[model samples]
Target: MFRFIWLSDQRWGQLEPHLPKNQLGARRVNDRRMISGIIYMLRTRCRWCDCPAG
Candidate 1:
């Protein structure tokens, strides 16, 4: 969701400057994929261990 991304960006701002020399933030991802996965979980109300592997 847009709110999640906005919050993530704010987190990145606080993290970017203090990260260790060899570290990067989280891997970049397609927001749509994340949204879809979340929707699937919400609709099904499945346990985390049951999530389908990509």
Candidate 2:
């Protein structure tokens, strides 16, 4: 079982400004949640297919 890694509010505040905005897409998933999952996967050296579903 892998633990989820969520960004703290302070960290997210710093990161929020750097994310893309107003792109040509229908919509996007929750950036914070997606980023947290990516962080967890990389830190744990887990395969992309093994990453937990949202």
Error (Å) of candidate 2 at residue 1 is: 3.6
- Model 1 shows how many backbone clashes? 0
> lDDT tens string, model 1, 1-54?
322222256655665676445447886565545655676677667688876676
- Cα TM-score of candidate 2: 0.82
Error of 2 at 26 (Å): 3.1
Prediction-by-prediction clash tally: 0, 0
- In terms of TM-score, the best-performing candidate is 2
- Tell me each candidate's TM-score: 0.44, 0.82
- Provide the lowest-lDDT 10-residue window in model 1: 1-10
RMSD of every candidate to native, in Å, equals 7.5, 1.6
> Candidate 2 lDDT, tens digit per residue, 1-54?
557799999999999999999999779889998888778878989889864565
Clashing pairs in 1: none
Model 2: CA > 4 A from native = 52-54
